[model samples]
Every structure is written in C-alpha cells, then in structure tokens.
Target: MTAGRKRDAVLRLLRAEPLEIVARELSVTAADLSAWREAFLEAGAASLKARERDDRDEKIDRLQSKLGEVLMDNELLQAKVDRLEAGGGGPFWVAEVEAMSPAVSISTRRPYGLARVCRVWGVARSGVYRRRRPADAPAMPRRRPGPQGPMPDAALVEAIRGVLLASPFHGEGYRKVWARLRHAGLRSSKERVRRLMRENGLSAPVRTGRPTGPRNHDGTIIPESIDTMWGTDMTAAFATEHGQVAVFVAVDHCSAECVGLHAALRGTRHEALEPVRQGVAERFGAVEKDAATGLSIRHDHGSQYMSHDFQKEIAWLGASSSPAFVRAPEGNGCAERFIRTLKENLLWVRTFRTVEELRLALLEFKRTYNEHWLIERHGHRSPAQFRRDQMDTMPLAA
Candidate 1:
C-alpha cells in the first residue's frame, strides 16, 4: 500500500516538473517535497527515493499503531498487577516491584510506595530475589530445633503409634495426639512425640469414611416425647470384596439412640423381628404380653415389615407397628435419617457378605457411636454421655 502511495506521489511530482507544483499536486508541503527531491538528487534517481520512502513510511506506520495498542494493554495490565501487589488477584510483576523496591528506592505516586513499606518490614532484598515466594509462604510455621534423640519411653511411644495405625479414623492433628496421649493415661504431648514418629516415617493412610446422607425431605416430623414413637429399618452394608449385607436397627424417635442393631444373613421378616425381640426381652423377659403406655413404631412398608409374621411379633411385644404411606419414605422420617447416617458412617465404608463380619464392624462402630463420637447438635456429648446424664436423674427401679 505504501509502495502504491509513493508511486502516485512520484508520478504527480514528475508530471508537475517543479517542487512547488509537485507539493500542490500531492497535497504535501513544499518542505516534504524538498526532502523527497534531496533524496532523489543524492541517490541519482527519483525511483530510489520512492522505494526508500515507501519502505520507511510502511515500517513507521506499522510500528506506531502497534505501539499505541501495546501502550493501552500495558496500562491495563499495570493497573491489574498494581492491584494484586496492592493485594488483589492480579499478577506477579507487582510483587516483584514490591520486592525490588527496598534495594533501591523508587518513587511511586501512590499513598504507600513499595520501598518505604519494605524498609519498615525489614525483609531482605536478596531473599525474595533468590526465590519466588508464594502468598502462602510467610504463613508456614517453622519447625522447632531440638536434640536428636529417642523418646524417654520408646516402648509407650511405639504403643501409641500402633493404636493410631490400627484405628481407621483416629485423626487428631499433632495437638490432638497430645490430648489423646493424656486421655490414654500417657504423660507425653504428641507435638514432641510426633518428632519421633516423623523420624521413623510413621504415618497412617487416611480415608474419607463415605459421602454424607441426603437431607431430610419436606414435611418430615420428629417425635418429641420418649416412648411415643420409634423408627426402625434395615440398612444394606458395603464391604471390601463381598457384595452386601443387612443390619436391622431400632432407634427411639425422641432420643435418637440405637436401641438395638442386629446384623442378619438375610433381610427378611425374622431379621426385622430380632430387634423387637431383643428390646422386649431386655425390658420384660418371660412376660407373654405387656402394656405400652404411649408407643408407635414407624417404618417403611418393606416386604419384611408388611409381612404378617413381623406384624404378629410387634403385636406380641404390645407395640403398635405403623407403616409409612406407600411411596412416601418421608412418612417414617426418623428411621430414614438413622439409615442414612449408618450407611455413610459404617455401611458404605466396607462390603460385607457374611452377617458375622457385618456384626463385628457394627458392634465396634456402635460402641464408638455411643462412647467416642461427638454429636455437636447434642451439646457436643456422645450418645452414651447423654444417656448416662439422663439416666442419672431418672427415678430408676420405680
């Protein structure tokens, strides 16, 4: 394009046969024409001048446009980097500027220039330059230096380490280890003890138990009075190799405590009745029938619960069996909730084929559920703690 423009200008100049006339023809000043004329005279040909001017003008125009765009982009990027260095989500150049500021002071018109602040912080210029530091770098705690030695009671330390390794979810940070040591009647803090474990490279493979259960559906009711209602159901278990197993669970609606959990080979009417038999046997063994003051057992109308055999068992125990509305599991809300918790926490963690295997796992988890696991919604106390507190105040053997 520049070549074409120059050719047009030269043609006009040549046609005019004079500098002033050529300038007039080409719509340029006389000085512009004179500059072109001098080049034509020195180079000994008007064609040479035309070629140089065309190439030079093309380069200049291209560079000028690019420079303008680059300037705008640079300004935008500078603003963003400035914000990030000023502590937004920009780039690293701003931090580099901040880091470099202390070595040689530079004036920034901003309220707080980088150099002044760096001086106040007393950070070394060389340290930042030597390595790029991340945002999270400064927050890391340095390890304490100590004598390289074995624990005073190496045997006890080994014992604590074994327990932590054995339990699937005995997770406490270093601090918790310290607390656990004291709880286990050991004198050492885990912080100091961890040093030994670290030296030995002792660490457990952590596993997330299972996904949390779905939230309670709409219009679900929770019983408020003890013995007024109960929620019972069978949860299918997951295992390592074998497919699935079943656990019959009975929970007091108000208390939400596991009244009974019976692992069964098959999820049938008999399995569902086991918990009822156990509950009744515990309360009034050898009695053919007993009066229930205010009792209702809410459950889904699964084939097992709907069977005549299961209904007769509940009748024999003198407790009314209330099946939820067909296609409405939410009608028996409490049992569904317990089932969800059981599945996530225990059942989903493993695949059990044999009922005995499921039983062993459930027994351990049940004890932990009763004794160790904290229920924050229940005043951060375990189920056992809550029960003991309630039982302590009750008029027992009345």
Candidate 2:
C-alpha cells in the first residue's frame, strides 16, 4: 500500500466506529488495522519523548549517507589503481600522474593520499621515501639485486636452448620451455626463463595480434569434459605433387586433442564429414546413428559445414549442429587455433610430395601433438596426458 493510504488507514483505525467496520470498508484485515494502530500510537509516543532521540535518528541517517559516499569513492579509487597497473609502462606510473587520466597526487590529497596508496599497493613506506634520496646518489637497482633463483644465468640459458632444440615442434614459447625445464628436474622461475629466452634469442617469435574490431558476441568455447563439444574447421595446404589439398580437423574443446584429421583434394561436404566421422569412430567406437549422442559440433557457416549432407550426418550421429555466427571466427576458435598450430608445425614448415604423404604427416603430427604439446591451461600437461588424467577422475559414461 502507498504510505499515504497506510497513514489514512491508521488514522481511521484510531477514531473509527469499530476496527472491523473500518477494515471491512477498506477490504483490509482486522489484524493489519490493529497492528497499524499500534505502530502509529508507538510512533506518536516516541515523538513526545526525548528530543535527543530525534537528533540521534537524524545523525544515524547522515552517517549512513556518508558511508555510502565513502564506499562509492573507494570503488572509484580502486578503479584508478587498476588503471595505473593496466597502463602497462610509463614514468608517470612511478608516483605522480597517469597518462590517460589526471594526476593521482601522492601528496596530502584526501582520496589519493600517500599513506593510503602505499597501503593498497603493499609498497614499503621506507622504499617510497627513498625517492627523495639525492638525485645523484646511487639509484636503487631497476630490479631486486642478485640472482632470483637457485640456477645460475648461464646454465639456465643452455637448458633453455636444449629444450628448444629437443622439441620436434616450432613456435613453442618461453612458458612452455620453462615447463619442459621443470619436467626435466631443472627448476627456474618463469620470469627468469622469459628473460633468459629473450637475452639468448631462444624465445618464439612474437605473434601478431588478432585482427581487432568490435566483437558481436563473446563466450568461452572450452567445455569441461571430453565429447561435450567439438569444433571442426578446414584449411587448405599445398603439396608438391598434389599441388593443393584441403585439411579438415576436429578438436575436443576440453582436451585440445586433435580427435580427427583428414586431407583431400576436394573440399566437399563429404570431405568435411571425414574428420567428424573419424573422430566419432575413434572416440566413441562407432559412426552409426546416435554414436555421438550429447555432443555439439561448432563450425563456421561455410558451404560445406552448412550443407544438407553435413547437417544430416551430424543429426544422424545424435549431435547438434552449431553454426558459428557470421564474421565471428572466435566461436570456432578451438578448431581455428589447432589449424594455426598445424600450419606452423607441419604444413608451413615441411613439404609433402603427395596428398597421401600430407595425410600421413598429419596423422603423425596429431599423435606427436597429443603426446607432446604442452598446453599452459592444463598446467603444461600434454593433451593426451590431460585427457587420461581427467578421464581417470571423471565418472564412467552411462
């Protein structure tokens, strides 16, 4: 009920002929009328009591309002700190100002006070005070002094080079290299690994950023379990004797394992189905109706993936066909990423004489990749190992 209506009803209950009579006229229960009358009488009594209580209530309201403002200011200050950390690199980040925003003064400013910023960032007051040391005085080392880890710098570089040389694949980054070093019982910090790689020219070439524009939609593509979702895509490669060949790939979103791969001269719908067919047979033990029940296939809107044959086959396998949004390749990023890896490691690096040769190479690469490629997301476990580990813990399929 509106406050005005409730107030009018309470007033009626006070001086009406009878509570039931007033309640009946207003379609409200007698109990509610009696409760309202009691509340009104209590409030009226309170009004006549110590005027100090009125002052106390008003003070409480003012304090609550002030608390809300303080909370909002804290949020804005937190965002400012986030902006500083996210600003990447800048001299302005040291103490005084931000490049994108106004000065965040470390002086006695109320919000960005020196003591408060230091507390939030966990910087020692002693270290911050050192900024006032004589300009020509020996400057603090850019990084903490001495070596960071137990391993010496030279030994670490040699180990990093050994990892790169021993790997059968190309384009492995310092993180994976670091993981491999640990697996070999050589411990080193990730930052030190990165530094040594950069200094010794052992790191992978920096990758170009993905083409940027406004994204139409966003969601994660990875699934929590194998066979829950799969992504399939096609890319073309050149073989010396075959001239050009189409490579179809199907990948499990959870494991990053190449469940199926195939190469053919014709990029037909049937050819596209080959990888999916192979995956179903290998992973589920058959390619008959409902073989892939509960699976969803994420693919692009290409003619082959959207073909009547392709859709029919997916349905026959008891899998739902999920066509990626137009112009949004990230929806099929699992397949897209595997294609890039395939190219960098095999298609672009090695030459095949025939389609058959390329097919054989793809099969071999799939095995190697499943057994060796260290996915950082899985704590650097190889795809095959991760699948086995998770499968051991996962309940048996019904």
Whose lDDT is greatest here? Answer: 2
Model 1 lDDT tens row, 1-398: 26467556665666767777767767788886666656655666655556546887989999976765455444444554676687765333445556444442122222333443434334454555545566556676545476533446467568668656654443433444544556567766556767655665554334675554564445545564455677788877654445565678877665666666888657889889776665556534532565442467788878899899988767766889877777666677667766766766677666665667878877777666657644444564555776677666667634
TM for every model, in the order presented, reads 0.44, 0.64
Clashes of 2: 0
- The superposed Cα distance between candidate 1 and the true structure at residue 83, in angstroms, equals 26
- What is the Å distance of residue 71 in model 1 from its true position? 27
> Candidate 2 residues 216-249, lDDT tens each?
6767888888889999999999988878889999
What is residue 91's positional error in candidate 2, in angstroms?
A: 26
- List the candidate 1 regions with Cα displacement exceeding 4 Å: 1-220, 238-243, 283-287, 291-293, 325-330, 350-353, 396-398
- Cand. 1 TM to true fold: 0.44
lDDT accuracy of residue 2 in candidate 2: 78
